[model samples]
Target: MTETTPYDADRARFTRQAPARLVLCDHAVDVADGAAGLVATEHDPDARPGGRVSQAVQLLELTERALVSAVIYERERGSSWAEITQYLGIGPAEAEKRFAAKLAGWDTAFDVPYRLDDTGRKRIPQLPTAAYDPAWACTQLDRWAGNRLILVDNEHPVSSGLVMAVPKT
Candidate 1:
């Protein structure tokens, strides 16, 4: 008989959570809501007819960003090109060709974590904010999963078992 450890339990929970694509889509919806809120506050409903079109265009950018992030997250989690391609309805080579540059950049960020800004004062992180600070990402994602997923234990973070190098603060 095998006994399951707490880590195993958490890993199981993490695996049960939605795939990266669905999670990213949920995030895109949240971003769209926020953008809509900003547009609503900044102008009247009838102020500009073209504003709606522009907002829709802007949301496309958010979707693109989310896609890239989802790819990065899945890759980091040890997902194979074949596995990812199945969801995208593309060949593994095509998927790799499309995302290779972004994956290279993500890998390179670890070598040089930050760069000086134009002012040569403030430091800007090269990695995506979530990648740069995985502990925080884990916390946030876990909380979101606990709230959104059914039968998840709120006390245990779903992503706690993920292997991430947390930067020392």
Candidate 2:
């Protein structure tokens, strides 16, 4: 089961702190194809070697932004800002300035509780088995910040693991 998975997890539950990026990525894009899409998009870049690295970093930032908002949505449910910041790999002050304060402007509806039971106790939220609509996440993603979500597949062996986001038009 784990072999076929795009992500490797150390625990089955979502911790009080933010889960690892691969785990969260797997959780956000639930469809196997979508997960594959994320992976594909992550690797696909029009830029050459140096440009490719920059683009990849941008895609990474986009993923972090989406994941941060997702975690913030969960925080509204009961999680703490401290845990979210930790997951974001930032300190409280920086988190407050760049992340936590942005929640009011973000789309709250997508901030659905990815977990239903106790995350810190006996029950932890596991990666979603359900499929997610890419077009929908794309459109909804626009609401969050004009950022885009992309997943492209080709005939080659390319496997992307990130979604690119740009400022909204």
Candidate 3:
């Protein structure tokens, strides 16, 4: 009798090379199931509550930072205001109003290439554009970074796409 290894070398290699984070946000039921499984398997009620609280708080803080970073990174990467607005689930003006304070100190120096019409009127929307604010961006970036997971909405362009923005140290 021969014994075979369970690991698939090809799949492991592909995963190792992929640069982006694979966030499975689509299918709320699947996410909930996964979360439930994790919670059930990873946590023990007998464990000290203090430790759990501390870990939760730390995770929250990290998530906030990752959210902000991801927003800024996405802006830098040339995402559109419309896209941003959609992601934020807010009107352009409202989103800007909410995040103005945190963005005040940051420079909107980054340029994004976008074609306005079929003729190709390339223009760069101002950094921290109305759609995204520094504070909110920071919060989102932190959230994404902390989660180390991606949530994919069926409506999003990249259905089942992964999005992870780890701040380069």
Candidate 4:
């Protein structure tokens, strides 16, 4: 017999009540780039080498989420599974099996938007927090990258040349 967690129960009970929002490729790339910048460099003294392993593990998780966001963005833009699978070094069938659930959740979030918490008062977005509020994600990620990665033009925003994918209102 399988044990069902509270999370599973709550997920099943969610209701769709809002318009769908688009998750953009540029924002997802920014998230990955900003996270990569967080990896400590040899010249950075503030980083404690003792905790490097744990920090790297955390960054790995962040990178994986960013990749998921990128895939979702690509799928929304009409990219074929074959094209995406080429980059992952996996067959299309396996790639679809791995990501289909996440892609479904992304689609569902635009319809449901949020669900009530245990208290039945709070609204928790079904979408990943970064994808749910892309403007904030862009601002925070831009700040993170700008602080760590040096650019030739200080005036240029880290997200320059990237177009935001906003849903038509």
- The estimated TM-scores of all candidates read 0.61, 0.33, 0.34, 0.62
C-alpha-based local distance difference test score of model 1? 0.61
* CA-lDDT, candidates in order: 0.61, 0.40, 0.39, 0.59
What digit string (tens of lDDT, one per residue) describes model 2 on residues 1-169? 1122222222222232222233344445433323344455555565466765565566676566556546654654465667767767777677767764555533231233233355633322232221122333223323332223444332211112222233336
The digit string of per-residue lDDT tens for model 1 on 1-169 reads 1322223322233331223333454455466565755555556656587767677777777778778768877886778999988889999999999999987886676556567789966667775554444445566777666766678766544554454333336
Order the candidates by lDDT, highest first.
Answer: 1, 4, 2, 3
Instruction: For model 3, state the Cα shift of residue 9 in Å.
Output: 40
Q: Name the runs in model 3 displaced over 4 angstroms.
A: 1-47, 108-169
On the 0 to 100 scale, the lDDT of residue 144 in model 2 is 32
* Model 4 Cα lDDT, one tens digit per residue, 115-156: 778997677777665555554544655666566657635543
RMSD after Cα superposition, model 3: 17.7
Clash counts for all predictions: 0, 6, 24, 0
Native-vs-model 3 lDDT?
0.39
Q: Order the numbered candidates by TM-score, best leading.
A: 4, 1, 3, 2
